[model samples]
Target: MNTPTKRRGCFRNGCLALVLLPLLIFAGLFWAHRSSQALPDRFVLVVPLSGGIDEVRNESSSLPFLPSHESLSLQELLFVLNHAVADERVREVLLDIRGIHTSPAKIAELRDAVEKVRKGGKKVTAFLRSAEDADYLLATACNSIIAERGGFLLLDGLKVESLFYTSPLGKLGVQVQAAQWKKYKSGIEPFVRTGASKEYLEQINALLDEFYDDYLGYVSKRRGMSRSSFEALINNDPLVSAKKAQTLGLVDGIASFWELQRQLTRKVSGKELARDNDVFVSGARYRSAVAWPQKGESDERIAVITMSGMIVHSAGEMGEGIDIEMLKNSLDAALEDKAVKALVVRIDSPGGDALASADMLQMLDSAAVKKPLVVSMSGVAASGGYMAALAGKTIFAQPLTITGSIGVYALKPNISGLAEKIGLGRDVVTRGQYADASTPFKPLEGQAYNKFVGASGEIYDDFVGKVAASRKMSIAAVDSVAGGRVWTGSRAMKAGLVDRMGGLFDAIHAAQQLAKMDMGKKLQIILYPEQKSWFESLLQGRSASLSDRFAAAVKQQVLHELLPQRQLTSMATFYEMLLTSGQLQMLAVMPSDIIID
Candidate 1:
């Protein structure tokens, strides 16, 4: 066919496709809705909480066109649990918590939801194989906890570990120069000190003590054990068998999957149950059926936008972190929605890219002028994460959440000695005397070093000023707590850094009150940055295709067996180079690292 003829045919095809698309979508949705409504009534809902729980559902792992059988996001699980509370068809909930791993803070949220389910008069049974500290903590909220025989209950208490790089950096002939506005800002300590400083140790120990006490108290209350005896039992036999756990009053009993199902059936329906023939509703299917609100029902909405992982200036290709532009877009959308009466910013990050944080804070502050804005800090919301929280009218955090670390630092790596050891040297040409001052071949000295000090001072002062203004404290008062020091949520609340010592639900409650919504009524939750549908994602190329994902998975396995990971070292080196070269300036990041076990 000629070019004109071909163009006309293509145009006609496009028109036809567009016209039929909505009808096709309606038909598909209608069939699925009808089938869901036709499901048999009055069955036990099996909520299988397995694998890692994420803040948001990860679309990268599943092909857009295919049905996903992956682990549920925290939001989805909460939705399911809440739905079951009012759902007449769901007689009970079987919590099949199998080999699931998550942070303690997340466990607290899940535990709260489980408690709500129980309060709603639904019996919740937890089935487990091996019970870790977090897993058991969650199971405590359930009415009955059944563990498999021979399974281990590793309830060793919490310990926080940090990594220090001062010795290693020194060996590489790199000296890190850092200045904090005051003491307690220990973010740079890891790069300059061999071990935790006395101040840092004191703060960390106090934080750990508080967290341990709270956890012990909760577990003791839930299991109906005295705190003193529970502590002794934990210390004496932290890692015990399932039977020992039952003996210690940690779990209800030991039973296999089949046995547990039979028990659940009898408990739920007061009758005998079969092996694999029970009509149990999958949590995912149940969630789909009840996730949406009833049509034409008027419910006030509170928009929740989650910012998890490192906060960066631009899009990250591989890292599962927050992007400034993406967050800005989400905020704009939430603000524009008339249905959304309030906003909640859920921040869980270790801090990054100070400039990006500033921009986001500015946007958040602007948004708050029109609507109530609240922050829910999860896990680690230090430095930039804390900065973003400042934009909220109120900040909420868990008792163990790591907050603060309001500080900035610059790292300059001088590898002159390393070059000498390798029989190599470099001579730089520059337009000005100070042009080559920060070159890697030499340590910054005199005027060059002073310039960095001045810049860091300004950044620190700016940070303190903002904190004071937002927190309604004097500059000196803010400085006392701002010196790059990390604080537990309880301490932060005492210091006026956080308004409430609670989790996301608390933040939501605060937002609801601020919006003047009916507290007893169900407030519709609207997630900002709406998840892309399969078709939308494919059209936008926001995620990888099925073939591409498979290839990447295979490549990862091959590389895992063949290569050593030097990426961490290389990334640090590159970052130092960038800072020294004046390409990247300032950082509002947590000075220390944390790993909880």
Candidate 2:
């Protein structure tokens, strides 16, 4: 009844439909895989506090053919800990702290979370393969600490190391002229001096003593030992074998991981159970299950804006760093949100560009007028970090947080000697005598040098004045403790710089009190500058060829060996600060890159 051409067309259309159906089915299955993954009803959450904990998580773009490497985030980890404590399905928690590298304040926050879980009647156990000062400090927060048999325990007290670039610069025929507002402002010392200045040594030693005392206090209280006895144990033998540490009562037991799991199961149920009978869920997996908005039908919210990393004009890439433009936008968004009852600004920065810091301070100051604002200082909130904190109604810092480096300085790099050594010359034309005032090829002198120093003095005066006004102290009192000197949070509190010693959540509660919100109520905490979507991340990520990756790897290794990672990051930030200021400008950056181990 039909023509042969019509029959052939129908046959081709049928083939097309068959091919498209399989593709659609595959896509649907792939999309629904996450929903199908079942979470255990009764499980122990195993949190791997391994590797560096970035303040925020950002995924870079890569080819579809490449594998993805995702790291854990501090914010998400904290959220999981909070959720698990209240989660009826979670019975216990196990923290695996092998090969974990993080700053002191982050460790403090983690410890606080662990303590919360313990107080919530859930058993928290920590297992360490190699225990160091930071790792042991975190382990003490757990209900029980387990270590691998014969593993190394390096509880040696913290020491901060600094590198001086004077000799190296001299050999390379480079001249670095720098000026600070005061004598104790040592941010420029590394490039100008061969050894640690007397003031710098005094401040560093005092800080070390404060941290050591705090560490001893915590361990002694947790282990039920006298402070004197604990000090003796640490001083007599800071480094010991895992078995020795267990014998000394530092750790509860030394056992293999399988045995530890069995022990944990018994602790949870008071019955010996086989490893296979136990159910465990990873932190990331559990976060996926629980880290969603459980917002009580209330419209009121509390905005927690995280300003971590170097404070710069802009953050070009993801990683961790404070971008002024981004922060301003976040503040504007929070201000615009009528439901936001209060604002909590968490700062973990060693500081950066003065202008950018000023801009952020202005934004925060403006916000405080509208809402109750509180600041929580993390690991290293010195220099411009402290500058920003002045805007807060109250400031809270972890006991070991480094702060109070309220000073300013400018650096001028003169490479004329290096150029001459290489037999290079340049012909320049200028309209004014100081036209090339900021050029690295020539030395700054005469009126140029004086002007630079004067500007630095002005910025320092401004910083000190702000601190005096905020802390209700005299200019002399603020300047006496300032001059680029860093302080432990305890000392800062005593000095009237910090209001109290606490973690970020504590600051949030403080904000609540100020906002007249009820205590113990779970208020919605909103993160500003919301994270990007997967598609947006892919667009932001620009993939490089294999050769470029190798080069970057090599460069990273060299920098790692040459200096601490923080120092390298600070150096990059320093250059960025210069570029943003567009002049021989002053910087409100920490004098020393603090690294506690």
Candidate 3:
């Protein structure tokens, strides 16, 4: 019954079907991956806290074709917690505390957020497999703390260590010539001395004492124990098993993950579930299911500009530091936007170039004149970072924030001995007396050293003057607290350096109040220096290409194979800081390399 025309038509239809089938399948898979899963009627939100917690979200990925692995930021965590407060469907919040690495300031912020969740009528429980000092501190904010049967708690006291390279560099025949404006400017001490100076020792011991007292007070008060008892317990047994922790009232219960899930199910639904998955929703999925309360469609907006890392004149790589040009553009855009009623500048920098910091301060001041500006200091905002913050109408910092290193220093490396050891020499002819002042083969002395000292003094005086004007204190009072002295936010507040002791959210609320926005109504938030995807960054020249990145990785591998990686890396980093703005520039930075373990 088949004819030639019928056979041809059948073949054509078969070919078309084969091509369409693969296209349909591909489309289906894409939709499935992009779509959000349906939420259950009532479920406990499980939030896993781990890894390094940053202040802002990072969108870069190694491979452009694949999605980047999500890392948690304080902003995102806060957004989720704030949304959960009003969400009636969420029965409870389960914080799965793992190996979390962040500053004490961030930990304090998160603890406050957990307390706010409890205040909103939802119980927050912390589940720990093993806990460190910071983990225990955060867990105390929860309604109850549950630990795995075999877990341990390491409650070791805090210790800060300072590394010095003076001996090693001397062995290499390289001497560092450093001139600081004040005695307390210990940033250069590590380069010049084998041990900490007396002044530095005094400052560091004071900082540690304050931190230890604050830590003891917070933990003891939260766990319903006297300070002396808690101090004695930690001193006696820095490490405790789960059973011991329970008996000591540190943990409410010792149970496995499944047991905790069963208890949660019974508490929420009045029945135990056969499967743990039936009652729990992950924080990642929950984020997709619920929209942020502050991100409502509103014409009124508050622009948040994040200035993290060192304050540099320009960055060679993206996110290298707070570049002056980038800050200028962000400020200009916020000032120009009519919808932006207020601005919140979050600073988390240890400071860098003195000139760039002054530029940033000027930009913020100009922006503030047109609209309200508030500064929120993160973990470490010292030296030039503090200078830039002077423009804020009000400044907010957490209790553990390290701020106020109001001084300047200049460093010049004299490598004449190294050159002699290596049998290398240079003959120079100069027209001017100070022409060779910056040469590495010569040590800065006589008129050259005097000139640099005068410059540093001027910069230091200007810094103190700005702090005095901003804090409304006399020059003597400001100087008394200044001179490269760092203080915690609580002490800074008492010293009249900070207007309030709070976190980023508090600063946002202050901005909202200043803008005259109704506190009950949610307003939109606009992030400055807007986050970009990897592909977009490549296209816009903000990020290096794949080939360039590959080359960098190869070079890093080769260096690790060739050298003592840690020491070499440290030296390279220090050298980079010296040359960040090109030439031997004076730095208004802090002793940021100190490690608090």
Per-residue lDDT tens digits for candidate 1, residues 2-116, read 6665556536767878757855875686576557644346778888776567666655323322344566777678777877888888888888877666555667778888898
lDDT of 2: 0.78
> Please, what are the lDDT tens digits per residue for candidate 3 over residues 1-597?
976765565367678788678668656754664463567788899988876666765433222223333455677787788888988889999999887767677788888899999999999999987998778888898999998879999988888777888898888888888889788888888788899988888888888887788789989998999999999988999899999999999999999998898889888788866754467888766765665426755689999999977787888633367798889889888988999999999987788888789889988888999999999998778898999999999999998888888888888777777888999978899998999888878688998889878888998899888888888999999999998888888888998999998988899999999989878878888787776543344346537864565455445445534552221121235465553422456888876443222
In model 3, which runs have C-alpha deviations exceeding 4 angstroms? Answer: 1-30, 60-70, 262-278, 317-319, 429-432, 533-576, 579-583, 593-597
Superposed model 2: Cα runs more than 4 Å off: 1-33, 36-38, 60-71, 262-278, 317-320, 518-520, 533-585
Per-residue lDDT tens digits for candidate 2, residues 1-597, read: 986775464367678788678668646754664563467668789988766776655432222222223446777778888888889888989898876666766777788988999899998889998878778888899999999887978876778887788898788877678988777778788778999899889888888787777778888899888998877877789788888888889899889888887776676666676655646778766765664533534667888888878887768632357888889888989989998989999887888888788888988998999999999997778889999999999999988888988888888777778888999889888998888878878878899888888889888888898899889999999988998878888889988999998987799889989998866667878886666533344334469644455345445445544553342555455754443443465678887765445
Could you estimate the TM-score for every candidate?
0.83, 0.86, 0.86
Best by lDDT: 3
Cα RMSD of all models vs. native, in order, equals 5.8, 5.5, 5.7
In model 1, the worst 10-residue window by lDDT is 564-573
Task: Please give me the total number of clashing residue pairs in predicted model 1.
Answer: 5
**Of 1 and 3, which scores higher on lDDT?**
3
